[model samples]
Target: MAEPEDKTRRAPLDAVGRFTATEAVAAALSLIWLVAVAAYSFTAPDGTGPLGIVMTLMMVFLPIALIWVTVTTLRSVQELRAEATRLQSAVESMRNAYVTTQVQPSVQRKLEEIERTAKQAETALATFTSRRDASLVVASADRKAAMAAPARAAPAEDQPALALGTPAEDLRAPLSVGDFIRALQFPESPEDKDGFRALRLALEDRAVAKLIRAAQDVLTLLSQEGIFMDDLKPERARPELWRSFAQGERGRGISGLGGIRDRSSLALTAGRMREDPIFRDAAHHFLRTFDRTFAEFEKTATDAELVDLADTRTARAFMLFGRVAGVFD
Candidate 1:
């Protein structure tokens, strides 16, 4: 079945046939007039008054006959022009329909696949994160028990009591695999009670603040790179960063509200992008980068490094972990 847009722009096939018929009739009449004129000139008997008179009379009426033929020809031309206008309008409408609707099905399918893969990746990362967190808790308990053990009563200065373990520093350490997965599963939002306020307080700590900034920067970079590839014109991509920032300022607008509204725009944009060779190439590049960054994060972050993470390097390491888990939020 034709889409509504297609139906709106579709021209009847008989329009062309009608236009051709009009042209053919005009041509045939012109040819017949030419043949009659030629035949009369050759077949008329010399010096025969009746024949000469008849031929003369025919010649006299020729202008009127030509006038009628001219009118018919003009009418055919007008009809042909109207038909051509209709066809052109239909063609333009079809072009719009093709760009807006027909080109999007494949892109929509691919986006759905990406969403599925992202969900699976998030699930796997969540599992790994839970296990890592459990391990940390167990390890901390063991350390506490060892430290709490009694020492033998002995003369002063004979031997020093075993040093007790201090609380593991930086309890809210940089995100681990599990933390990253959690963030992806439940993205941080101001909508959650005290979520934004708590985040701000966390940022007061130099370590957490730096890590948060790094994560934001990484997302910005990825978004910029994607825009760069899609929009070859520097001016077009230049404003993209501002668009992202504006989305944050506006508090998610349509997408942040969590509804189908965002999907409609996304689908439309994806369809347009798919039709653009430059955008498609850029999208593939961005996808590859996403995959590579994930691999690096999964391989490089260790439990020990996650515990005492303090510097920008550690923050970047955590950001990488989050990226791999597809929890850029």
Candidate 2:
């Protein structure tokens, strides 16, 4: 079915279209000569002059030449159509062979790996969540008991009272990135596989997505001017110190955003991304793709480990952006 369609699309110009200019002229000449011969044959009384002989010869052979030309042309056209069909079939076969031997297997392997990773993450998340819930329950009960009991004497000056567990927020304190520079100092984490899955679940929350994007936008803007995360030194990682540079603070041996050649400030770059339609659309697309990679992580209950992943991933983004931007030497 497809082969005939391909041949039709690839049909030769001379095979199917109107006759060429030379062919048209020849056909027209033949027709005019035949008409002239017929008129002369009817009017002439005797076949004795040169005109009679010429007319007689033309009338006899002209029809034979026209018939021979038509037959030859029809055969030539049939040959071109057959050749086009064969070429089309060969191309289709080669394309199918390439897809079967190369593209299909590679795509199949990637799909299988993604499926396997998702299952592992799901199982890990469930186990982590159950343990966290049990801890929270125990912590709650102890808190209730302490509150209902009478007040006790204050501890000695050097001693501090210890509880079974600390508050949930305190446990998750490591994820906070109030100072972007401080968050990126460390790159080594053996638990990165576990952490990655935990963070994937955390990104399901819109707030986490917004934070990561903010850091990514900052890095992307800096990269445009050839300035990079790695250009930033460790000292520049502190939130207060970095803000000093961003705010164009003096007394650092440099002027307002002096290191950058574009004369564009970080504040301005950030504002541009925030206001521009193109950038907003790009940010939305990034989050959508990022969310898809860890879609299954969000289905289970929340675990402290998952929350930690969110924190770690956010801080990691800042650290990575800074390093890539050369913010830390």
Q: What TM-score goes with each of the models?
A: 0.33, 0.30
Report how far off residue 153 is in candidate 2 (Å): 45
Instruction: Please estimate how well model 1 matches the true structure, expressed as its whole-model Cα lDDT.
Output: 0.42
What's model 1's lDDT at 104?
Answer: 92
**lDDT for position 307 in model 1:** 25
lDDT string for model 2 (101-201, tens) is 88888999999899668656654664454433343333321122111122457879898778856645334422222222122222326555544543443
lDDT of every model, 2 decimals: 0.42, 0.45
lDDT of 1 by residue, 165-265 (tens): 53343343443343333232223445764445444543544433443554444444435434211121111111222233223322323122121123333
lDDT of 2 at 314: 32
